[model samples]
Target chain A: MAVYTEVPDSALSAFLDAYDLGTLLSYKGIAEGVENTNFFLHTTAGNFILTLYEKRVNEADLPFFLNLMEHLARRGLACPQPVRNRQGEALGRLCGRPAVIVSFLDGVSVKVPGVDQCRALGQALAALHAAGRDFGMTRANSLSVSAWRPLFAQAEHQADSVSPGLAARTRADLDLLESAWPTGLPGGVIHADLFTDNVFFIGEDLSGLIDFYFACTDAFAYDLAICLNAWCFSPDGSFHRDRAAALIAGYEAVRPLEAAEVEALPILARGAALRFMLTRLVDWLNVPPGALVQPKDPREYDRRLTFHRQARDARDYGRA
Target chain B: MAVYTEVPDSALSAFLDAYDLGTLLSYKGIAEGVENTNFFLHTTAGNFILTLYEKRVNEADLPFFLNLMEHLARRGLACPQPVRNRQGEALGRLCGRPAVIVSFLDGVSVKVPGVDQCRALGQALAALHAAGRDFGMTRANSLSVSAWRPLFAQAEHQADSVSPGLAARTRADLDLLESAWPTGLPGGVIHADLFTDNVFFIGEDLSGLIDFYFACTDAFAYDLAICLNAWCFSPDGSFHRDRAAALIAGYEAVRPLEAAEVEALPILARGAALRFMLTRLVDWLNVPPGALVQPKDPREYDRRLTFHRQARDARDYGRA
Candidate 1:
């Protein structure tokens, strides 16, 4: 739950004046999207989402994220379309933070996604990758294989404090991921953090995808790997082969994977596991005295890393 | 900001099955109401607020609160109308907690409320008091004069930790309030917690009053006193006499204050101050480690107590 910045009523009223959206009927600070303060706005014209970029989001990367959402939406991907202000600017200042309003998508995110939802997610994700192929912008994936060691270094000493022998195991995983990380795969603008919560669904239909803060130019298969780690893992940290199979089959229905991409899946899955583990490890060890957000247990990804470490081929993940 | 309970998608979908409210288009955990989990539900039928009663609210008192809202709304008060399910029940279970859905009110709450807004709030509050008069059920104000001493006892040790000499000062105020607190001065059901955030205004018109968890049978003047402390104090802790005057005058236009009620205003205001101060002091000291909701500063009410400590008559509060 994220609402680090409290947008004052007067500030919000003044901010809405700059937009063509009609009289602000009601707005609420929505407890969603960890990286920013989000408000669900209902106005005379229509419902929309007002996002105030927080400290976690890089100000320099604002154009990349805002443009990516607009780009994805224009290309027929169901994503939020940024609403430019009267000055034709999508970005503006509100309460000393960069803020923008976007069209509100209508769907609820599944906590434990079903097999059908997994398929829907895979198809939507593939469509998102296809939609962003021609958008003339690029952001290097900051949490990819290259950043694992540095990220792990921050939590090295305290990692075992969370779980005994976690530090050594993480270091070993990081070493393996760095050495075996794939150099060439079908690369494009990818939703680097498409967790189940980020994708919305109305029943079995995928309504839209949101929270593009971590999106960057990276392997599309690596994005697929992130989904496998996120969606296909059971609460007990066991991998579900059926969910993974459905996800992969759904993706292939949109765009077939190359042999290299298919074979590289296990390593990429391992790398994705390592990436999330490192970040969560660092965050878990450094949660402030009274943070609203409880850090996601790094052990979840650690277990996923363990599974990927032993898997030899895509067939192990139920890829037909 | 409050979202203590996270209603999973399946649980939410199943919960909505009992209602005629069309297919759930979207729902987000709204960051509002400290004592309950609130979700802004937008459905094909219309927008509504789904509130799951948390620990802070007493389960047995649900009927009094829910019935009062329906009663008040029936008598031409602008407030959330509780939507009963097909079983003719307004209260139901969701996520293992007592929950209910109410029609959404459209307006934004003012932060630093303007004089006009204060006037509107005054009128609306009086109307709420009037509308709630005939409501058969009643709940005692749990944070009123009788609760202050026991509440203070809980926070006594750490009272000085917040501010030097606060403990002794709070004790003296408690002594004065216990002995001199007015009784039998135009009593009715009062919106005891009608703070600025609970009163919504679109421009200068008060659209609605919400958060009835603290609504109780108490002196109408005491509720006015709470409003005075809430709306008429500047950030500097100085009283805004003009705003207070506007508020009282606006309130009297709807329901005239009796001579006894007018005369009891200063002491009631002080009692109101002490009530909030003691509760806030207890909350401030006992906020659990890593709490999402920050306990409001007791010192704000402490300062108001200081102002009311010296105030001799209703004239000082701009109550003409």
Candidate 2:
């Protein structure tokens, strides 16, 4: 729905021309996303997704996103690898926008992922982090610890509308996070947006991961925090200790968290909640009418941030 | 940064000519939101926020939003009241978009809100819910329980690359929510997007609330669930039991939750989380590269949803 680009049919045809994906049978715009122009293309070769980079995407970062898929795919992560053109370029021009074609992965996103699924996601994430250790590319975490205040400052004038004492509370949290930021933890390319939709699965088995646009070089524990927030909670703002434990065990099995990282989970979760709350709050206030994109409710992240503010221990997640 | 429309000087002048806001000294765009084009306006009358409705906001709902603000303000809520023109019209054209002028409340949003502040917010929110009971306007909750699946289904295909088991899990959650949706709770106009940034405070005192774009007729308990998620969580996705208790107590102090409502908190929280996660997940796969709008990390809602799934007791929220 948020197709900001007008990728031409010719561009898609060109991609088909270059790639070894036999013949294109059909292409239809996937009408649900808020960012890129996505076309679900059915070809004699196989089903694939053609994504035209939309405005919010950085052209310069295309390689990292494209190559990360390739890198992960090579490591048997079951992700959709970018299809390279004849000139050996994964990036191409489609509908006048920067475009790439990826294999259409099969599987539904788990709406109510079980504890085992959460654990699998954790393990897969750890494996991805481990594999990213040598990806030879790096991007700064745009939504990292340092970006909170400035983002909040941008909305300070109307901050009262979001919550009473939000600005000050955020400032205090920022200070706390800054002073107590975990240092020297395991670091690598972190999938900053590992929500349920970004990961695919079949039944209890994990399938693949997608949407690495927010991938960045940050402390691996931050990724764990992201996962803890993503996978270990139910929809009603309650923490599932079992799921949390399963997820943590899964991650620790692959790449054990450092003592400092484990200790910082609560605070890190708080930071992550703030980061999302700020962004969502800003978005909520500025949703553009006529645009197909849906404005998210900022309160969701606000609740998560509130939860993290009181989170005292990892065991609080569940009976350890 | 996502200013959908630029309000020119002429548009402001025309608006001033129609409204009784005296003279407009200057107005400039505020670049903190992704939904509406907001301008900080200084007039002889007072400081105000000039908002041009952006996408995802329905034009038909303008009167409901404007009137609700006026109603709340009239009822002694310290929120921004929409200014009407001579024709008794609150809606107008600015920068080729639907626009309105709102009296900006004076106060700074505290970044580090204390327990007292949290309690105050809870009380204020309860007052807001109480105020909405007889506002003479009603609009269905756009993010109600029934809307979650269709929203997620819209973006389901695009999310395939994220995790292997995401799709099935999402389906499962949807099925569960559908089967377990609570029927017949107290219903009223709710500030569905009440995050910290939307609420303001003067020092430790409550100032006012703003941004009523997502206000709609929904179950009051659902709104509470939203606040519980927004106000009770830390940034890192852990539950803040104290704040949760403070907030719920504050809400109960004004308008107590029904026994059924208390019992349904878990599912309500799940529904709320699912509502947001679906929206964020949809946004995640859709963000365009060059748009001023930032893509929210869907993982944030994923964490909240995870929390809701495991929520067992209100005591876990510091509520007895």
Candidate 3:
């Protein structure tokens, strides 16, 4: 829910001239992506989304994100395909920021996803992983296991201020995750932050997946682990095992989990919880001045960490 | 830049069931209106704007605003006509707040409007006033000249904090406006808040006028006064007489201003400035917790007030 850059009318007209999107009819700054400025564009040709990459997005990675969308869509994945300009380039500059236009995907993201939606999400996540198997580009997961400890160090001093015992518990969890994090468990490209908000649904069917900025080469089971932390938890911090079972079963139906991947699920889930908890804690501690977005409560992930600690196997996640 | 209410998927589906808008393909919360939740809805039927009226708008005035849009569009003015549901109702409750869907208008609002654009705006504004003459509804301007004094009182204590000597200068201006404010100079339904953002244009052609929440029965000259303060001022607080002249002339080409209305322009402009200044000051002083929309600087209007103070007659506004 942000518009970090304001594109002027002249700049917009100039920017659109390079593309074959037809005459611009209307465009509005959409409260969509948090890390970039998005304008929902209406033109004579069709509707599209114009994204201006903010400072948080690496300019060098623009090709990776745009090309990956094209790659996924080419493989029958429902995602926004980047519209190239007359020069055959998907990436360009607008208002001195790297920008691209993508075909608008049709669906609404559910706030509290139902079990069916979770199942559909699981299927789509597996499909995405399968589609990216032969993609030409590769981006290492920046916020994966190795980054968690340093991220924790930045927020360590103030972690307990969020909750009475958050600091000590976080330190213990970090030590556990660092010591026991799994390797060689069917690694490939994963939508690392496949939260409910990133998956759009039309009724019970998943229509599209969006915000591929966090897409990276990582273990496929770790992606499922991230989803368990994101989608299987209720507002009361209770894990909905039915939804988890549906999600995991839905994933296995598409691409069956290997024995090692199944074995690594618990620790990966714990690591996923810690990864989010550390970031949220840091954001909670240092919210920028006049930021419109309220930093999510880090305690939510802290509770997930507690749940993952006691889970003994993939069966505890309702995985059949 | 506001979405105060979170409309759920089931609620949205049920809400759309009442309308013939076809299946909702996509909807994104738009950062458009300041006082309401706005979503740009794209459906099989077509694009439309879904507005959820926030607490700031009076529920009793819903009919007036919706009907006025209906009336204006019927008279061939380019504006968002309120779409009726199957029950023939234009307004319904969504997320426990009154909501209305209007036909989407195609055009971009200029951030820094050119002189030709100003001329188009003036013509459209006059057309709007003429079109609304026969609309069988009346609403008093909530933030008109009479409301400025009490609005000021709310922020008077902190007025100087916004600008040095602002409190003292505002009191003097209020006295002048109250004493010299003209009466019986051709009143009609006026778009009282016709700023640059509210008027959309494609190139130099006025495409649409929107955000009619501020529309009310008021002096037509006062509407022009608001425009003069809004569109005719440069970024550095300097007035552009050529742009002002073009605006008034373009307006007169459609609906000629009476001599008395012309004579009243100077004081009307001053009153317009005071009205916006007081409201902005109060909003600036008392911003609600976690407010997404930044309160516009009250000092912009204060600067306009200073310019209006020395303005002698309509001639000063480049009215030929």
Candidate 1 error regions (>4 Å)? none
Give Cα distance to truth, residue A154, candidate 3, Å.
1.1
Q: lDDT by residue for model 1 over B196-270, one digit each (tens)?
A: 889887766788999888889989999999999999997557999989998999899999999998989999999
Kindly report, for each predicted structure in the order presented, the TM-score of its chain A compared with the true chain A. Answer: 0.98, 0.94, 0.98
Candidate number with the higher DockQ (1 or 2) = 1
Clashing residue pairs in candidate 3 are none
lDDT of 3 by residue, B159-228 (tens): 9989999999999998888888898989889999999889888756789999999999999999999999
Model 3 ranges with Cα > 4 A deviation: none
CAPRI docking class of candidate 3: medium
**Model 2 C-alpha lDDT per residue in residues B1-27, reported as the tens digit of each score:** 445664544456666788887755434
The sequence of per-residue lDDT tens digits that candidate 3 reaches over residues A94-163 is: 9999999999899888888778888888888899999999998889889987898889889889877888
Query: What is the TM-score ranking, best to worst?
Result: 1, 3, 2
Off by over 4 Å in 2: A1-320, B110-113
Distance from true position, residue B1, model 2, in Å? 4.0
Model 2: how far is A146 from its true place, Å?
A: 38
lDDT of 3 at B157: 92
For each candidate, report its DockQ versus the true two-chain complex.
Answer: 0.76, 0.01, 0.69
